[model samples]
Target: MAEIEHPKPFADWETRAYWEGCGRGEIVLQRCGACSKVQHRPRALCASCLSGDIEHFVASGRGQVYTFTVTLQNNAPGFREACPYVLAYVELEEGPRLLTNVVGCAPDAVSIGMPVVADFTAPDRDLAVPRFRPA
Candidate 1:
């Protein structure tokens, strides 16, 4: 089995709870209390309403592939094995487009509006990264 070279997630005060949620196999996202908008890349405030009141909740883990590209090469360590993998932006059912990798299917099969679901991969104890696959 080959390893996919994905970026390490940022661990900070604003995002600690999110990573913890991933460890428990939940796809988490932030929702704005003011606008009821979902946002990825969790923050202290809502991006849509700019309100400081944001709530973290588990996502349905179902989404659609908004866009994607097949990478033929990578310079990052341990990422060469995933040269032909699909890197995609998935639009969650919750209404946020998140940056993630699409797997469990042929790269050629990936297309816009394709349905997908979340898959969590932990390369190390402290890291839990979210990848998506064909639903």
Candidate 2:
């Protein structure tokens, strides 16, 4: 099967650490120093308490398939060739639900609540995209 050609992800000040961590084969998330709430899609301020004291930490990379769907059709360049892929929201053990793909298995084999672990694509120009696979 042809791999989906993911577009290179660029990082801004808020997400620089996350992109860097992925490049290092680690999944990183943010925690609020004030509320101690963990979040993904890295941001400068804590979404819960609006605190600027957010800290980045390496996540365990373990999660479960919270929900998912198999995309049989996509007109977009990279995705079009990768039909029948599993698109899922993986609920990380750290509390963030990352919108990622579940690979390394048939789409029909994936299910809700299935255990999974982080898998990263080879760094393309210094950035690695995170995905998941059955644990």
How much does each candidate deviate from the true structure in C-alpha RMSD? 1.8, 0.9
lDDT winner: 2
Query: What is the lDDT of every predicted structure here?
Result: 0.85, 0.92
Error of 2 at 113 (Å): 0.6
Off by over 4 Å in 2: none
TM-score of each: 0.88, 0.96
Lowest summed lDDT across 10 adjacent residues in model 1 is found at 1-10
| Candidate 1 per-residue lDDT over residues 8-120, each given as its tens digit | 77789899878877877788888889898888888999887799989899989899999999988887777787678888999989888888889888889899999999998
In model 1, what are the clashing residue pairs, if there are any?
A: none
The residue-by-residue lDDT of candidate 2 on 54-129, one tens digit each, is 9999999999999999999989998989998999999999888999999999999999999999999988766799
Best by TM-score: 2
Q: Residue 77 of candidate 2: its Cα lDDT? A: 92
